[model samples]
Target: MELHSHRMTALVLLMAAVALAGCRPEAEVAGGALDATDGDPPATRTALDPAAASAPITLEDVMEFDPRYLIGISYPPGMERYPGLAAELRRYAEAARAELMAAVEDLGPSSEDRMRAPYDLALSFDLLMETPEIVAVQAGGSLYTGGAHGIPLVARFVWLPQRDEMLTAASLFQGREGWHEVSAFVRESLHTSLSQRLEADALAPADRFRLLASGGEMIDEGTAPEAGNFAQFEPVPGVDGRLRALRFVFPPYQVGPYSDGVQTVEVPSAVLLPHLSPEYRGLFAAG
Candidate 1:
């Protein structure tokens, strides 16, 4: 399930806030935002060529409705094969791109921090140049037929920028280290974005909450004549004694005049484990 609109919008705003706040130090490294030159190889056009690989796929390319998800093209011999792999590839790629866009836009302008402007610019530039890959991680064992969880699958895409050269997922996940890696990127991005927009003035709190509440009210209206729902998050304790929580709220909010009438229903961790990205799942499993 997708995140409810209000939360999505709020999270986007919060993520922007955090990115601007400089909460995490490794954002530059994890997001590949600070390791490239001004003229690093531009995002190639090869992704447009069906027979060519190594090209970066844009979010728009994967959003098109089609049976073939990988830009309506097939992978070459060397490309790894997996069931429903093409579709999953597109989904993850689009998701990754969307997150990247959100992260970048939240960064705002560089005038706020003239000294760090170059760092922000470097991150933006590297993001454009980086290519993310998807990897299939086994879920270990299954309960029913002893086979894998077939219908819903999980996968991981380790985003290793050629410039930074991170060691590996194992190295990153050593005692909350992996999550710190991701969080760091998000933090830096948030800090950069926030520092720039600090003096812009805050939105009206009353109006903002009212807008979200109205959206929630609309969702309540749509619930059944007798049924009801509530928002929540389910936490799954990690093997390493840490808790990995997955919170699934309502569908993303549709922006409009009455968009404020929305409510989000949270899904449990067990329900979401099957739906997480492979990379996300691996980080928890390793913990």
Candidate 2:
């Protein structure tokens, strides 16, 4: 069976930025990685500055296996300047593409027949928040391979450009002790949000405590703040360009039913600052 082809349509701010800014496509390589002949783009080192207003890093769509399976990936421009980070992104994208393809193949002999029906598997990434210290990107999409409904997933990636590696909750907060504090804050925030929903009749009182308890249980099982329960996060930048609040993301079914959709809770700077390491605290301190 052959997959259908369609002209790519840019989605959301990241894609739109690439389109509007006239980001020229780099020479395509056989594999998913793009070559960086040009020196690292300035955007890689600094936050997106309105004064300069350079185009945001654009991703190229690689591993397109018909309409049934496709993977669109791109990293911070000039990522190639940092060989380690560039290699990591390539590995991640390729592994993700392979995993999705394997799932399609698992559909068996009926796979082709199933493809004839409406089916889609798409994965895309977007730059969520960027600062001199941390760059956060979100990878999310829906997969429908013959189910009652498509499965929606969202994962976050935090990059420390200076360190030339990815950031985890432990590393960011300096130790497990800080992570424990973060987890507690998340639980409190979740309970408060649920309570508000119940009061507003957005959620039935009968389901309120059960759902809240499930969310808390999931949080407790994770060793660190971002282990399993709170895998996605973005730092809200303050007016002064410092970290303001940390946003925790939960996909559908993590906190509530599929109909409830994705859930997010923001922990303000005041709440998170005291728990942060001196290193990270400096990143958010007012100038």
Candidate 3:
């Protein structure tokens, strides 16, 4: 216990040394390790002003006293209304916490020279688009544990109020051929984007193909026509209260090297309308 306490002191110093703006812990909000079985918003979250309270719903928790790690998890303001959605988000956050704890346990005695924080987790779920038909959220965040960089995590959720069902990429489409078509469209967009970056127009045909192939392989593999490959998406709503397009999100290392960071491709509704399940076709609009 004596050694453990000393190590915790080190964690504080390490966090202070590397903490970024707005990364400070919330003294009021306790750790979210336990479940809120009653399905109510975490009571510890601060109350918003009356004007803001009536708007979006938010649930956030940050902890810094763990001695071994630090964590932050927040949900969009409107999420509080959907107990089911809130529960799913909680489970996701808990899973991340478990992973961080396990990593901490496996860690050997801390050396005095290690400066980076041992383990840190930050997850923020943002409301992507909400229409009367469906509400979408983009879940993006990172988890770090003694590495040159933190691992990126992301997912998307679509909630149907009328059916009380959560829709995923797998559940949103029909036949396998549809996935193949969608895959092709995404690949074309990504390929063109890569070509522009490599300045293919300036290179000789041979050099263009060679240079494009170097980076395009990862893009192709990452965007295979499987539903899972395109699971993380954000809906782009048209001003007419309809869908304009859907942006597919790819975290680092999925479509390219970590240095490329996160990559996204917007597949216009025209391309996606044909592939969408019949029930969801009305949610989108072309042009």
Candidate 4:
């Protein structure tokens, strides 16, 4: 969804191409906006997608007519081979779908707000790096549920086929203290970036202070000393096949305003090695 009208128009057109093309959209509302009445019969004089007079609103109808409810999912080149991972990704999309259904129920069929910003979900996966050591993947997308903009969903998975489990951020560190160390480093980096951006904009002192104060709070909370706060991290591999760094990913509204978009801080191996769990240390080259 676009926060601005012009962008909204553009995104709607693009979404028709990108998102509508998948999930086998419904026939009734198949063409455009959900509550639109473009093809009403002369007798009806008025109608909506899933057109109340045409048929009852069912899940299938929603999927077929409203492209918004149609979850668009795409996998990387060889992700299908891993049934476990594939199932996990599908579950994520299904959850969003369930939520969309709930919202539809909340907003009755005749609600005008339903036309404001139709709900939607689109996910894409990138097979960042795959090897015997680890199968690193990054999954990201947007979920729109009638807002000015869609909420971002992002995740990083380091699948260990040998261990038959994921290498989560919490498990990678020795103890709670590791989070504190990484938190401090990431917080500093993000704050510095925010300062540079504010200065570059050359706003008045009052505006600068207002932005810095609000942005600082978000960065602090988003980068707090907790594994959950820094849940999404991408592993950067070195030539030697060892992890050279971890790029922590913070979705928009987590570390800054939505306009600022997603932000990241790449903590090199040297900065992370000290706090890494003994067993996990082998995943990285000595920094």
Candidate 2 per-residue C-alpha lDDT over 1-287 given as tens digits, one digit per residue, 9 for 90 to 100: 21222312321332444343336453221111111111111111212233222223334454333645434444444444434434444445555556556666766557555654334444454556555677666655544444344445355667767755665554566555666676777777666766676667767666866766775565444324554455457667788877777777666655554555666777778766766767668657443
State the TM-score for model 4. 0.76
Steric collisions counted per model = 31, 0, 4, 3
Query: lDDT (0-100) at residue 248 of candidate 3?
Result: 83
Backbone clashes counted, model 1: 31
TM-score between model 1 and native: 0.21
Give the better candidate number (2 or 4) by TM-score: 4
Q: Which stretches of candidate 3 lie over 4 Å from their true place?
A: 1-60, 110-117, 200-211
Q: Is candidate 2 or candidate 3 better by TM-score?
A: 3
Off by over 4 Å in 4: 1-68, 111-114
Model 2, position 239: C-alpha lDDT score: 80
Stretches of candidate 1 off by over 4 Å are 1-79, 87-209, 218-287
RMSD to native for every prediction? 19.6, 10.2, 10.4, 12.2
lDDT of 3 by residue, 68-149 (tens): 6677666655566765566566666777777777777776665731344456665665566665677776655566665444
Better of 1 and 3 by TM-score: 3
Comparison by lDDT, 1 against 2, better one:
2
Judge candidate 3 against the unseen true structure and give its global Cα lDDT, from 0 to 1.
0.63
